[model samples]
Target: MSRRAFCERHDIDEQRLARWAKNYPAPPRLAEVVVVGELPSARSSSLVIELGQARVHVERGVDDELLARVLRVVGSVC
Candidate 1:
């Protein structure tokens, strides 16, 4: 059955339904999904990295680039 016929049979107000439909539009479709990189799982215990009174607590599976920069700063200064 058509929407109008169904609405009529169900005793629904067509004009009110049409107004609501116009007011709230349907969600847009997603054209494509891109996966940049999978996130690492949380570690059971945090890893403590000490740097001369300054400490940085990190979880497991940290990015290599971040680790490199941190080490360079600590090693260069100390």
Candidate 2:
């Protein structure tokens, strides 16, 4: 989904969205970082990190280490 669409749908702040986009995990190819307000299971906020040209779901988990690994892969791709 487009950034605008995602932000609007989730009622996310435009500035926060911009920051997320700018501070994407190290990998250039795996660029693009997004934080969801709810995890869908219990509405608990969780972070989602994606990679690849189209953000082809490299990894997903609530743990920071896992997310970091995913970003590392993305960084290597960069």
Candidate 3:
């Protein structure tokens, strides 16, 4: 059925629905990455993680708990 009819049946304000739709759009589409060169060696000191459009570079000597927390937060948002 129509959006207006559905909202009316559900006791929702049409204006509020419109505002929510305007404020929160759909999630973005994911893109594919192609690597042409050689990958990093196993002896590299740092590690890189690609989450969505975010690139997290973690160096050596970082705390494991702190890194886990950071990844959790970044993962939720990204």
- Over 1-78, each residue of candidate 3 has an lDDT whose tens digit, in order, gives 576996797767887556444433453222354644666666768867788898889887666556655766787799
Which segments of model 1 are wrong by more than 4 Å? 1-45
lDDT score of model 2?
0.53
* Candidate 3 or 2, higher TM-score: 3
Where in model 2 is the C-alpha error above 4 Å?
25-78
Ranking by TM-score: 3, 1, 2
TM-score of each: 0.36, 0.31, 0.46
What are the per-residue Cα lDDT tens digits for candidate 2 across 1-78?
766886797777766656544555542242344655644454435434444462534333444445545556665685
- Superior candidate under lDDT, 1 versus 3: 3
lDDT of residue 21 for candidate 2? 49
Q: Cα RMSDs of all predictions?
A: 21.4, 8.0, 15.6
RMSD of 3: 15.6
Candidate 3: worst-modelled 10 consecutive residues by lDDT:
22-31
Query: Ranking by lDDT, best first?
Result: 3, 1, 2
lDDT at residue 11 of model 1 (Cα atoms): 65
